[model samples]
Target: MIHKAGRASRAAFRQADDEAFGAQQNGSMSKSMPTAVEAITGQNWQSIFVPKVNCCEVAHADRAAVLVDGANYFSHLEATLRRARHSIFIVGWDFDGRIRLRADQPADISPPLGALLRGLVEDRPELHVYILVWSVSVIHGPSATAPALLGSPWQDHPRIHMKLDTRHPLYAAHHQKIVCIDGRVAFSGGIDLTVRRWDRNSHRADDGERVDLDGTIYPPVHDIQMIVDAEAAAVLCRMAAERWSDATGEKPSSTAGKNDDIWPRQLPVQFRDVSVAIARTSPAYGGRAEISEIGTLTLDMIAAARTSIYIEAQYMTAPAVGDALAARLREPDGPEIMVVMTHTSKGLIERFAMASNRDRLIRRLAKADGHDRLRVVYPVVPSPQGQTQVLVHAKLIIIDDTLLRVGSANLNNRSIALDTECDLAIEARNEADRAAIAEIRNRLLAEHLDCAEADMAETIATEGGLIAAVDRLNVKMRGLRPFSAMRSPGPTRPIFGTSIFDPVRPFRLSLPFVSRGRSGAWRAPEKEL
Candidate 1:
């Protein structure tokens, strides 16, 4: 999460006491949305720059089961399937089973992930296990997936219908995190099973004791996951399936993977009392299917939140959405806003994606800052001895304990306007979840500041958010440099916390679309997990 306050002046974004600013949305929307916004805005909503769907009425649920994050590859997925007696369906940017699951499992018996998935298939032959992953390889790991010149076990699996999503643009990748079990449970958020995501709460600097079946230590990385059940998760599963059919020329699922209406489980089940809706930033669905769903969702959430908005993502470089948020903070009654994310710096490969277009988007929202209403911060696990940048990969956000979204989407153009991403949040008014989510946000902010979670929690409760809490503590981060060290020290440049939030814009974002070059994609031949 990079701070935009330093760049506030360059963009004419500043936050003074009791000053509020709002720009009416001027964009198109589905037939139903503008009517609703008229009730809120007291004017004819524009259907141009700001879409009308942004004001759609949201649904509140009763309760939901929790989804835990365990590097969410196959092993953890298998564990989820084993618990499901009803249904099983999957969607991903890609799903590979050549890896193991549990770090402490004995290796001699079978590769943890492959064997476990196999077990689920055999034990419950009646179960439907459908898997969908991205067709292209965008960012592959150092140890490439095992060469498939000879063929792999996944080719032989009978229950799995794994396919690549080709609906992506030539240079874009299908980036979504989704899992549906029996239509009763689902999980979405940023945690993926690719190599290097494994970590205990310890956030170890070194994988000294971590090992796969091959017995090697991978570097320590930090990430987050969103767990949910029933209505919330079901909605994501259905949307992912729709995308799979669009990408691979398959029909909508005969049974399990349709709109949430086909769900056997009734929604609005017990889960406190909050309005939760599913959001997406997929590429033109089929051909130019409108993307305002995600945009509307972000804006709606920002407006509804009366206390604060806490976002944690890998990339926080989306301008339009930033501008939306900036306007909200300018409101006299607007909520406190907190932005947290991985410190995104353009490496050689990432540089191509972080070009000027990216800068302009960031500048749009960054123009609104230095106000008491907005604060941005990033979390990093310090090296045991010194500060070595630990990439923060969690795509998370908590607004006033009233909203919590976790998934693979970053706040960027590609996510909201191009690539496919799945993110969900709990919009409950329940105290338990609200308290839990708020605590998690505070704990993460503490991680960035190198302070105890307990202390940060207190400060946040005192100041009402992680950013204000960090400021109140007056405890400069230990391993973390001031916001100036991450990028440029100048006020016009990105400060230490980058890609977290833009307080002046009219929207919020997922990470931007990842950029690619002519070297071509390194994907496994159409088979395998």
Candidate 2:
């Protein structure tokens, strides 16, 4: 039943896989990897964004911007929500109604997210708001889940509907973070509208405003959210509505006639008149075909990179991704790779499972980096207490100056094939678009290095590449630090070593002790340590 385009896409992927295999067997990628001459001459420049293979569709976006941190994303989200005249749909792994979208402002002026939504619905008769959060999040998420499970004043209104999404397989989470306003604009990325998530771009170690519901100050965290308008936004809006309908069995009213300009005036647009591709990762369930568009897109982008590949992720234990990066590293003239991740996972369970696997993958990648073109580090900021590592929660990737992707899917097995995820990607088609994408990458590197964007760009030019520039600029009190393998202690290691906590596919109670891997092999999941 596959169409011509699908067959062509499959053929392209098969060719890539065959080339990679040949390179591995030959111990050199001179025949497979693109040469510097070809890259510079712009010869055989085929985009990796193939619809039905790496993405759902490529839609036109009138305007788009990458919100670097939580501060920018939350502020813009609040503004856009207030301007929603017809419909507002939000989907997230976690959503705390008690958290203030704009904590910098007074409570009276900028109320909590729940209170703000309540007020908006009360003021506008035609306006309706729909929120969907993962069902299991009520148990594993923050304290705000109690209010959502029980009755709350904010969701008491009929116009404001909140539902817990239980449409996925057991142990599979709905991990997408998306917000669409009146079908005019949409926000999608890693930032969740929850507590302990908001922090300024400065990432001061001791920000007074970065606190939880109980007023406990949390460590600084960094995340990204990409905002898009026009047809792209409408596509996301439809996706969000479809998710709601699947979970709640009620299709929300369409926003056909409610075309209010909801783009936040304060937010700056990074790109205009661009093609935005929507990638997703959804587990197969209820007769639905599994979608691994994000995973496929990530591999294709890595393969297509000519100069550099920049990544910021919360976790780095996806086996296929590690193998792909390792293969690239073995290339004598491969693109330089820079990865920014958290110093350590937050909870004990995560630390035991994710950290061990992360170190193992890092060691593997390090071993394969024969030409030393890889740099894996975590960001830190100077506080009054001393230097503290900033919790990097952003899921972002930049392939040279050609492509930019931001989404909720972490570099983990669960995100690739098990959990539901969404990512927004844009490919540069012109010089202006390329410049904008490169500037955004520079801005992110500057934020991590605690240097000016212009300085980062200059350093990259002077040092020849991003890896060299990072090496030069990372000698500061607040900057990136390399990771080292650390042994996990205790017998709980073995319990968590299994993919029981982070399966690559849907969980079946009948086969509770086994899980299906990407290769369609049934094995007892165990993390290599």
Candidate 3:
């Protein structure tokens, strides 16, 4: 029997669905084909990605840049931190103080991240640094560096306030990764300020610099970080403060002054004067209502695609997203879909749960692709020894060169409904914005193919589509390979594996086994086991 609260949720979702479908029907009836420039720039963006109610406010940024890999991101972050005059706030899933910031400097010249921050605080009397990390233990096997050191020296410095967030529901985590400096500039995306994340754009199969605190080498890792300034930076600072308050029960007032320019001088601006949308996902916990704007935005973007949908994520298992994609694929002239992901997951539970679900969704989408418009591949670069597949941990989506999104949320159930996530979406508002968005996508493709950006752009123009361009450029040396599905859980899936561990719906076992209702009514959730 459907519980009262479950019924209410279903009803609310049905209402949302009706509204979206109604809007789409109205949009379809319009007999107007916009010009290329108009379509790419101001193409009904407000209708496509509406702001989540009470989740995030629309903000403006004077400048924005997309840092492709951790190497560039960390270097720019270190530079910004070095020049931070008032305050610094970092919010992420994991953070390690031992990770070295400067790869080119000697040990004496370049200190560890912890030492660097400590020295900064000591040098600047007014500088106050705040770090908030998820309170969870993880064993990254030999692939990643040291285990996250969330204790001691991280909080030993009086000026550096460190907090392990435990305010989330059971098994749910605060997964938003953000960094703000002096309330003027902010960075957000999938990357955490941790070890084993530093790597050059080349993504060499065997790089000496990709080492742990103990000098142990790891595989190539890729991620994206979006930088923003002006009101966008202020919005991120406010998010940090809200999370800090939620975790520590202390409302930390912002020390950031408006109009302070903290954007790095060395970084190139990818887009100037762009409006950024900060979408979030936070489960209802500690008396707060759940926020799923990021999830909504993901689905809306997928539905809004007209030509192509390009995505790079760690995992793909959200049912709502999969259903939306399947519907789009069934359309006769639907957008071509291209997804880039890790060949396989690393953790045992993730492999069993996420991969199992991913394969299921892939099969579903494949069945819906009657026109053969779907392509899924993983990037692999060949070195002197053997083929090394670069791990695709980037959470990014590009829709028809008109919309670009980057964030910490994975294409997974947890990211949609459980963990806290933050994403920045930029709608192309002019020819420059469209060019920047396309350049970012082409640059990513070039990096994977180990080809020049100009060549990549030329090939894409020649081939007329990204998939065909990728197919033509893909060679044995360094190129994207079709993802081979790993062994799936098969027809009789075990409930204890996914349902209990990587649950689609975040549940609080310690609570009174009740779901909050709009009318203050409570009811038991549907039985999962």
Candidate 4:
């Protein structure tokens, strides 16, 4: 199927490109600027940005809460799993049953993750759990271990159904990390149910708890997760069921029970009866249509911001998002943009693929900051020994006080086009909702700046904006550091990360396809994923 589609796509795009570029003097053209009111209202967000083929339904969560770090997310998720009654659904890019759920806490008197699930099924005759994981390639062996090689403990219980999804095209991954419990509560975010992902909010440089299966401590990592209940959870349940059917050609006959509310007892509820938008990204394969709602919503969020745009992610190299931000920076009354990222890319391949294009985007954004409204920074934690750069692996964005998004999708071309991802967003509908959203943003800044939330709020109130607040409180040693431009081969150099490794499109129509030649950026294909 992919081979036939690849050939048809290449032939069609070639003919279309020849005709489109021949009629135009310059191929690089910007989209029309939307009015401030129209942008803020999000009127065109559904009509213009999102592809019509996506079936992401709008739903409401009776209650919702935001979890800051791995400590909070893992602990609460464990509790929710314990409270499950009818069904438990988990979908992810990776899942290791051997990993401990709460490693920081005592050696869980219950059991390891795999054993715990088995025990749960053994105790409850009616409860069933379904787990779906990507069938990763052999090259990823160092990072991913085959469960079957380790005795396949997840298959010990008949009630526990486990499957590997190999339905996506080559080089594409099922990158979403989601768990739905009893059709009443759901969790979606970047932290996978695997090892080497446990850290407290303190982000201490030498914490002993950041360990893996071998008890080897790793670096400090930071991420976010969101918990939702009620209709929102039901919607996620349907999404998971669809994927299960697509992968195995059989749908499990389990449904979420409305009477069984699996909301964690300790987690505080932040909002009640709020609308939640579930966005997704999938590659075009088999007969399934591709969806790219995450990228479109990202562009819309940037366009609609009135005061500020706060972003924290592992990568910042998406050309469409960069263009929208650059357009905003060119405006005199545009909102202030502040981006928090990791100090450096992790491995050599990541440095070339991700950091190179990131350097280019930062330089380009700086050039467009005529009013000095753009600030790119990375956070560092102080220690008695030395400073350690905290790995900012959270995918989050806050636009003014009106919109908040947290999820598994990063601000990269792979997330936007070639990888399967999921994101949850909220749009404030009233003054109270806006204040709650603002508090979350302020709390995140407080965590990064190592100050009280009250203090951070006061600083923002007095300094007039988030950028000014960070600058006023940035005198301390353990705080955000400005991003310095590094020399690449050129402003538009095509590195492997930005080119071959993470192509902008999922189709294998060509070796390398350029979204914009002058900018040297890749965009998702109009006719492909």
Candidate 5:
């Protein structure tokens, strides 16, 4: 039986859907689509960003750019780090001290990350560096935990502080990847500063540059990051400081007055003078309330899409998100939906836990795709050894050129409610903003389809929709391929169905000898066995 509150919530969502699509039913929405200005500043179209509901805040950015792959993101990050003066904050799920920020540069100039940070502090006496990483990274992450737990030469400086965060609930990870320099510039997205996450946009299968510190070669990968300046940077700085304080019980000095013009000169700007929203996900623990702003914002963005919804993600096992998408697919005149994900999970544990669950969700969505409006795919690139998949590690979404989101959250149960995450979003304010957003979306699709951005745009225009364009251009050796649902073996089926390994909330442990009364008070069992 559905609870009263659940019924009311469904009703509210239905009303919102009707209001958003009413014009289409009257046969005028196609001709009367809201202009960019009207969608952003007018009351007729309710904005998807609502403070304390879907996002923490909406702040203005002087400039913002999308970094498509590691080759682009790392070089720009290296340049921006060189200009830091007062403070730097690095927060992530994992971190490697041996990785070079600028792999193309010589070792003398672009040293390992640890050496570079030490050099920066030595050269600038006023500068301080702080790094926070998840405590459980030692068990399952790519970075070596020995140096992080014990002291190393790079971590000996008094001005440099590194701490492992253990404040999350059991099985939940601290998954935000953020970097703020002097409160002037900030980066937030899926690309982590660790092993097996660096690759060029070309995604060449045998690229010589894709090697780890131990000389182990890795397969091609794909990810994204976003850099922003002005008020947006300051907001991210504050958020990082708060996380640092929550973990270590020591608040670093405020970065209020150190905002200098430190935007990377070489990075191209995607939007100027646009508003950006910061969304987060933190589970309830230790008296702190749960915050699922990113989850709520994703649903709202899906509900508001008028033409298409594009996504690239690492996993696709979030029940609520799958249900919302299924509902959208059930609509007769609904927007087209496309999702690009990894072809296979990485390790044995990931295969057992995530892969099986992913197939289940895909099957559910397929059942609800009555209008043929859904396409789930994986990207593959040509290799001399045959075709190899470009591992998708990006968390991105584009909704009808009206919204763009990039973040560290995966499309999984933990990211929806249990894990910690941070996502940056931009809502198009005018025609220029809309065009910029569309260009980024097209650029990503072009990279996947192994074509030029101009060609992608022309094909989409010619074919009348994204699905048609993809079909028309996906004949090359390197292109998108559809995903097929897989059935797990007998032994693992029940384990995956229980969802114990991928719980959506913190584990609640209770002793067998105790019982909870109707008033929520713990007491001894009336009849003990």
Candidate 6:
């Protein structure tokens, strides 16, 4: 499934008898993690749901802007930098110059965003640019995944001296995406610019040659992104500066990527009047580990939505979070929930820590959906070998269109509690703002379902949520269905709630461990039920 650079083959996700994603990490079970209530009951989870940013004001909060996904956000960001009048700065878990912003063009010209900066520097002398990637371990397991052949092209770029962040706890990463142009617009989401991630709205699952990463076609990938202005975007820029300094041992200049003529070159796109918050999840360099802002924000968001919660993500594997969602859905008046993500099978990387947890994960979400308010799904690609392409790699959420969360975080244990994730949320406090958010959410759904936004809204209204609407559509048009998997029927043993209260997540001593396919190490993943 490397996509391009090789023949397309459909191989079943074989259950490796060996451990997945490297070596076994042995630590003191009793003292390593934090405590959690077995049940986030009526009152326990109530405090977290309140809107962090009150969006109820009637005046026009800045509308009409773009919010980019971290994965591919950098592509258009170069356009932002070329157009800046005041400043330019960035933050993320990993920043690779080998990734071309305009992959469709020549390498020397589009050698990632860094070279473009050098080129524009002569034309627009006022522009300044900065970048901050995570300080992951040379440990390699969950840290960096750069392509070997391309080499580090950004290293030599004049305007951009990329800094790798090392200011984090033992088990965490600096995972946030921010871009500010003249301090007017910003973007936040999960898509990254590495390899094998480029695709149009067609979402061709089997077509790997379309969205090429390194000039050669890769896979049928997809990403969710947005644009924003002033209010939220400004905060994101500040966050980037903090991280930039943390990595470089120097502060990001106020005029990092500032240019005058580039502003008019890029159109100022608008979405909705949504209030957003920018937060980080980095613990002290070591000592008592703690979940970052991203995790806290998710739990808080889950508790806030009154009607429904719809999410689009790349990966999914968090048990306490799954349990929290489940506990919420049990409420007679709890909001419905729909999770859309790629279905990573018992892959070599995921099997170690999550093998036993998969069934539990699926079953928990499934059982929650059984109540008619919650469901989990993944994008699919049609192929003769019966293989499915679950490549919805955008991390976003539309909560009743009243709240939108976009950033570099995934809905997994690693992202929630381990990685440094960042997101920008828009709170549609008024009727008009809510409508605009709804409009965009439906538009995105239309792209996925291959329909018009108007039609998608009607479907959402008809079925109550996209998950139900998709189910209803599959029932009627079985053949037109994209690749997908519905929530399974029941709970699996050793599931999130099956055991007594343990201060920390239950880690298995017997489960097999393995390193990532490219390396040789170990991590935790699900085993058998």
Q: For each predicted model, how many residue pairs clash, with residues at least 3 apart or on different chains?
A: 59, 0, 0, 1, 0, 58
lDDT (tens digit, per residue) of candidate 2 on 1-529 = 0111233444444444344334333433323322111122344455556788888999999999999888889999998888888899999999888899887788998899899999999998999899999998898876465687895888999899999998888778899999998899999999888888899999987777888877778899999999999999999999999999999999898764355577899888889999999999998888788887887777777766878999999998765577678778998998999999998787887887688777876776787788879888999999777789899999999989988999999887778668999999998988889999999999999999889999999999999999999999988898998886422222211123335665666664443347787888876653221
On TM-score, who's better, 3 or 4? 4
Prediction 6 global C-alpha lDDT = 0.52
Query: Which model scores highest in TM-score?
Result: 5
Q: Which stretches of candidate 3 lie over 4 Å from their true place?
A: 1-47, 53-55, 138-150, 153-155, 258-260, 486-497, 508-529
Where's the lowest-lDDT run of ten residues in candidate 6? Answer: 8-17
lDDT of 5 by residue, 243-356 (tens): 999999998975654545788888889899999999999988877888877876777777667789999998977655666677778878888999999988978768866887
* Candidate 1 runs further than 4 Å off: 1-62, 65-78, 85-87, 108-111, 138-151, 209-216, 251-275, 328-335, 344-349, 355-367, 372-374, 430-433, 446-454, 463-465, 472-481, 485-529
Best by lDDT: 2
Off by over 4 Å in 5: 1-43, 257-259, 486-498, 512-529
Once fitted onto the true fold, the runs of candidate 2 whose alpha carbons sit more than 4 angstroms away are 1-46, 257-259, 486-496, 509-529
Candidate 1 local distance difference test against the native: 0.51
Candidate 6 regions with alpha-carbon error over 4 angstroms: 1-61, 64-75, 85-87, 105-112, 137-154, 206-216, 256-268, 271-274, 286-291, 345-347, 354-356, 368-370, 384-387, 463-467, 475-529
Ranking by TM-score: 5, 2, 4, 3, 6, 1
Whole-model alpha-carbon lDDT for candidate 4: 0.75
Quote the lDDT for 181 in model 3.
87
Off by over 4 Å in 4: 1-37, 40-55, 137-144, 148-151, 486-497, 509-529
Determine the C-alpha RMSD for candidate 3 after optimal superposition of all C-alphas.
Answer: 7.5
lDDT of 4 by residue, 1-529 (tens): 0001122222222332223222222323233233212331333233222223222655889898899988899889999998887888999877777777787666656357888788787887888899888878223522346573444755777788888888887778888889988888899988888766778998887787787667776778889999999899888888887888889998876767645557888988988899888889886777666676676667667766788999999898765566677878999999999999987786787887788878877876787789988889888888776688888989999989888899998887778667899888887877877888899999999988888899999999999999899999887767888877622234632343344664655655543464655567865444432
lDDT of 4 at 313: 92
